[model samples]
Target: MYINPEQLSSYAAKFINLLIDYSPKLISAFLVLFVGLYAIKFINRIIRKIMEKRNLDPTLTKFLADILLWALRILLFVTFISNLGIETSSFVAILGAMGLAVGLSLQGSLSNFAGGMLIIVFKPFKVGDTIEAQGVIATVLEIQIFVTKMLTGNNQTVFVPNGALSNGTIINYSMQGERRADLTFSVSYDSDIKKAKDILLEVLNKNPKVLQKPAPEVFVKNLSASSVDFAVRPWAKNANYGAVFSETLEDCKTALDQAGISVQPFTLQK
Candidate 1:
């Protein structure tokens, strides 16, 4: 049972050589990992600043940057792990399967996200904008990936999905510098159309909020079965719209009353 001491010593030296050979590879892998992570953070910070400078929507900007940075960092870490002699293909495959399952589950959410991306890029509307969409009228509060939040005149919050919002007609009332108000209060056909028009014109003229560039126009709109329909088109600033609408309606009633115009009540069928 006598063994060669030299052979035993040679085997021990071989073991030391192997360990020495693997040490640099291990260090290199760690170096790459740290460097990749730092790079991701640096790049993400730069992107965030650029987005802020460009006046991008804060919520969208942060969400996208975070997702991108984390994605890149995970990919780099996977590569680094592979460099360290670890199997990573199966991990990636599992992640891909989970992503597919998640995608299927979030079909509606994906549609909203896609729509929100389009909105952020195209800038159809933003917070504080008064827009009409899906038959709902409100001021935009925040535009989220899945939904656009709005505050109604009654101070109620309304959440409209981006998918439905993007698909439907969005009437941006604030886009135009001036809005032409349409106020209709029918009078008896026996009432003189000329007199009504004159009275409306007078009221519009006295109003300072009404735009003078495009003069107020009052004309016979339609001949109804029981009343003479008169259309009054008065241009006013977008901000003055609500108040002007109310005041003009009152002014119109006053003018009609002073001019001896008679309003017919709705008749009920017995």
Candidate 2:
């Protein structure tokens, strides 16, 4: 095609006019973008410091900070486009529609994420805590955005969804720093109740793992056709709960056996 010098010069002049008209806004947009980014960084740093001082979980801190950073960036991007004389209402509408579609498709995941946020903020349980939730008793290994990794007593790794975990009943055994071990021992109905009780108490007292402040107690819990049941309650540090429970059970039986008090099997009620 043959080019016209006059038309070519006119096109160039229009391009220059457009650039000149938008230059100030463009500069302002770039300036805002850089300043906004720095401000976001400063805000995140301050938030992290506050969360750390409040002893919030490290995982939650990082996750929240990243989320805030991206949200601010998106807002800044919309402002930049608007500054360049681009209509932004339609752009924002499109983003909202896209977000709604994605949110609908990820309802379950969103529920779990919300539940995780609640857990992290309220702290119903923490890592290393032994919690019983969803009928599974386990020690918390990690608390992720959607699931909590737990190590069960049988050495199994279980991933419990945060949605169910947060909504259900959670028994945190380590929260109180101490746990009471409820142990029941059965003896032949012929055994002396007082003597048996003394033996059980002695067993608990001798165990170094048992806490002394709460004071262990042993009392007759039930009387059946063949045996008498003793409820032995012992308080110990959460870390020693299992040890105290097992050791005291063994020691109580040994003491009773030495006293000629025959230990009997628990009789089932019809």
Candidate 3:
């Protein structure tokens, strides 16, 4: 179809008028968006500083800051759009619907996220703590948003989802600064129980790592067909637990051997 010059001119004027009418709203929207973003950043900075001052958990602090920043930015964008003569109720509805869909699809991730928050809040365990959870005994390396990392005694790294970690039983070994080391030794029935107990006490007392406050204990715990068992319990600083345990066992055996204490050999059952 061929257009007349007059019609073209009229269309151009109307388009120009429409642009002029929307220009102020568009500029205002852009200006507001820019200013709002800057304000959001500033507020987030303040929030981070507050969190730091409160000594909040680092993982949860960063996660919360990111969430707050995104939420505010989304709200600012909706306001900016509304300024451009867009209806915001429908926008909010659409956002809610989209959030529901995303939530359903990311259910496990959301559970993990919630679990992370719980861990941060409740503080069942923290980084560097020796913990046993989910059938794994390890030191907590990091507590992340979705997973927890751990280092086992054998120097193996493990990653467990936060959901299971939060929901399961957790044994925090390091919470107590000192731990009791329980050692058992078997001696032939011919050996004097009193002599064995005294010797074990001597070995425990000589160890500098063992604590004196609780005092060491040595008692005949069990009597078997082959030998009598003595239970030796000593308290030591958690940091020196392994060393104290191994050294005490070795020293006890050496001292007993030197004293001619007879130890029965273990025999396997057929």
Error of 3 at 196 (Å): 1.6
lDDT of model number 2: 0.88
Question: TM-score rank, highest first?
Answer: 3, 2, 1
Where is model 2 poorest over a 10-residue stretch in terms of lDDT? 261-270
Pull out the clashing pairs in model 2: none
TM-score of each: 0.76, 0.76, 0.81
Q: How many residue pairs clash in each candidate?
A: 0, 0, 0
Candidate 3, residues 37-87, lDDT tens digits: the string is: 899999999999999999987767887898899889888999999999899
TM-score of 3: 0.81
Top-down lDDT ranking: 3, 2, 1
Q: How well does candidate 2 match the true structure, expressed as C-alpha RMSD?
A: 4.6
Candidate 1 stretches with Cα past 4 Å from truth are: 1-45, 55-73, 76-86, 266-270
| Best-fitting candidate, scored by lDDT | 3
Q: How much is the lDDT of residue 197 in candidate 3?
A: 93
Best prediction by TM-score: 3
TM-score of 1: 0.76
Clashing pairs in 1: none
The list of candidate 3 runs beyond 4 A from truth reads 1-34, 57-60, 83-85, 264-270
Off by over 4 Å in 2: 1-46, 54-60, 76-87, 267-270
Residue 45, model 2, lDDT = 91
